[model samples]
Target: MYFPFRQLLASSLALTALTIPARAQISIGEPIPFTDTFSGTLLDDTFLVLTAWRTDTGSVNGGLFGRTFVGLTNEPVGEATVSAQSSTTAPNFFMARNSASLSVENAEAARYTTQSSHGTHTQVEFFTPTSLTPARTRFHWNVSGLTSSTYPGVVTNADLRFAAGYFPTTSYYDFFDLATQENGGPLMSVSGTGAFSYNLPLLLNQPIDLFYHTVAYVGFTAEGGETFSGFSDFSNTHILDRIELFDSNDVLISEWGMREISSGQVMFDQNGRTAAANGGNNIPEPGTLGLLALGGAALLGRVCRRTKKGN
Candidate 1:
């Protein structure tokens, strides 16, 4: 069953307010990199698993409205389940299981619209133990599995976004579109099973507090006949095999492979303070602002649609 939008929002806000600083897990001064291979039974303490959703229900002419945001650490909320699961394909890996089903019937109006989405985000927030700036940095991750399916009358798509940076507010917690190069690192998408990396922008002469954020999302939408139904299932998908961090000289600084996750040495903070301390103007690499601008445009489109419906 789905939680009420207002209730979900209230619960998320309360959780955000109660979150405390994460313990120090990684020290930048060391040359050795930290890594986890997921060989353990449980997910390491270095990562925070979060589940969220955005559901819109309304007539086609009236436009879909209502959005609920839920951010829970290491728990399932709505149709999304964030956990560490094992399977034949992937013996040990981080998985985000999600499914959604909805139907709309408007016999008199002869119009109907249905939209549902579920997302799971794994975030690792950390701060530099000492003042140390690198010439460049690289964030790498491996995806082991991904799957998506949708029933007739419905169109579905699965998207993945990876980002890193200092996000100090609760507003940016579960929303992937809000991740821009300024407050967070540039958003990068992964299509299928494989490895990916991002060349992070340089931050000079400041105490650094950062978060590596990755989310797997599946959405289903349908609009047509007076009576229609849609169902989607995305399970055992978006599995992470390993995540590694490298410094300017290409030296591995930290890694989480799931094996030694506890000893992986990557800090996991829920509430970060770097942005507030640095005046909230941490700039991104040149030429990457356009990516976020496009995201903003998409968001604006949704707002415009709602405005037209008098919502």
Candidate 2:
């Protein structure tokens, strides 16, 4: 009788460990509140605020970000890019958000595994037309869920990747640009998965806006330099409950939206399609944005012509 009771208790504990929520879904039009957990000088006043999480479900997890440059010029600035500066400039656009949680749970004293995942994401709201004096101006935006995140269980390291340009096949793909400092050096690269910051030399006198996204990847080997694999053996897993963004003073400025991601959701597919929409996501072009910009231009042109006739 004693042996049977012990076995039942052990089985119950094992089942509880195996069953966990991997993904969290929320309503699209809902209003999520942001609380200030940091107080200090910011990188910029404008921020791409967010929150993040981890779950017991998937192999590949991801978040989404969006922006609009409405009422700006239609001329392409080529690909949109981001620049990071210690100080803000006239017409300068910047994202002031930072990560909150950086460490995983202590497994030595605990029973389960631990891990972490993150990277910054920015989408161009708009670019200033070459025809415009400032070149690039104006921006509108939103961030992907969970700007920061972590998960641990047989996983040792995390990797962050950015998309300089991601679009739907229904339209031509336009490259969105981002600026970042890698290994303590400043350089810009086109936005896409692989490595490094992708936006620079593009932030002079431009009022820009940014959006960010983050994802957590779990590794199997306890050692570093592990290979990427699909979600076939996540029966034993760890969860990230909260994600935060910190400032220079080490304060939490923003927290990410956290949820367990369903498995096999590759952030960037072989053909450049994001797993978020399976291949249905779209990016807009300068010309398509021109129609909206043209409305204001038409009014200005008419005003200039009228003044000439009166003179």
lDDT of 1: 0.28
Candidate topping TM-score: 1
TM-score of 1: 0.39
Candidate 2 structure quality by residue, lDDT tens digits, 1-311: 00000000011111111222223212221011100011111111112211111121111111112211111112221222111111100111222222121222221122111112222222222222233322211112222213221323322222222232222111100111223344433212221122222332224322221222222222222123222221111112111112222333443333221111233233222222233423332221111222232222121111100011110
| Top model number, lDDT | 1
Q: Which ten residues in a row have the lowest lDDT in candidate 2?
A: 1-10
Question: Each model's TM-score, in the order given?
Answer: 0.39, 0.20
Instruction: Estimate, for each residue in 203-269, the C-alpha lDDT of model 1 and write its tens digit.
Output: 5433233322222222222232233334333334443333344456666544222111222333222
- Residue 31's lDDT within candidate 2 is 11
